[model samples]
Target: MSSPWFGSQRSQSMTEFALVAPILLLMLFGIIDFGRLLYIYGTLVEAANEGARVSIKASSPLPSNSDVENAAKNGAQSLYLANPCPNGPLPPTSGAGAQNPPGDQGWIFITEPNPPTTVETSPTYDAPGGQSPASATGSCSAINPFQSGTYPLQVTVRYNYLFFTPLLEQLAPSIILQAYATDYTEY
Candidate 1:
């Protein structure tokens, strides 16, 4: 009896552990990766919301494209406890003066005047070949669109999130998040 108990049982248990160890490790890694992904998503949402809130401020004239970029960077840093923008800075604001147009930029939006419409033509810029000529440009209106209570403030944020875990990186190299909000400014 003693010989029977010792001969095969110990080896069987060892074999079971050997068979299960890798699976267990992979499961643990999966859980960790999922949690990290969730955290990143939450952080991105908060950052976008923060950016939108900052954009609706009429009193301060809303942040410039650079300012919005900084706001996003700060928001992400605060939420993630790490800097998300390592390539010098987050994308410049989307409005004029930005290195890249807002639509093309990675993050940030400003309430600059929409491009002007020509009296000679219907609002056609939305269609192909509708872009105004370079000489057709005019200074942005001094009038705040929100003054008449018709145009509400708009906030938009774009974020590029990088995974902190190697496992997640291998699965989904990176993630992009976008958020938008609309609210009237008191000013």
Candidate 2:
């Protein structure tokens, strides 16, 4: 004769597994999504740092806006695979220049915190927290050099991060991650 417990054990185990499976899967996917978010954010920060480093070097000819931008792009090639989303966040303040890059790839903004002694020729990309200079257009551009004083060179990188998990999408349909690197310009 089959024991009562033995006869029902298989069904009970299956029921328990069925009840716990969704939660476990959800947790597992949640972890994966979180990891991806961290990785992308870290990459963005590293890219900004790299661009700032390139900008700070005392080269015979200062690195052009493109050069610094290239360094940043190279630093985070993995981001290209990510599905591009619309630009995230407006410039710091309403008046501040729009920080979002024109292209889906992203953009690098090189700005001097302290106004340069000479008038900037490249068309100011950002106002003192206002819309990008009317003269400046495109994703990246080199700001004019400062005559004196150790002013900080700020490199800001913006990228829209797309979440893989549906739940994350519900919570955050569009997420833009920004990273900044500041280094004193080499005189």
Q: Summing lDDT over every window of 10 consecutive residues in candidate 1, give the lowest-scoring window.
A: 124-133
Against the unseen true structure, what C-alpha lDDT does each candidate score? Answer: 0.44, 0.58
lDDT tens per residue, model 2, 1-187: 6686576677889999999999998888889988987888899899878977877776656565566667778888766522121011124411345333332345556665432322333633221121123332233232344533455766677776666778867887656677878887664
lDDT of 2 at 81: 21
- Candidate 1 structure quality by residue, lDDT tens digits, 65-182: 3444456557666442222221112243345543322221244433322323122122211111111222211322122223322244444455555555566678876565555555
Backbone clashes, candidate 1 = 2
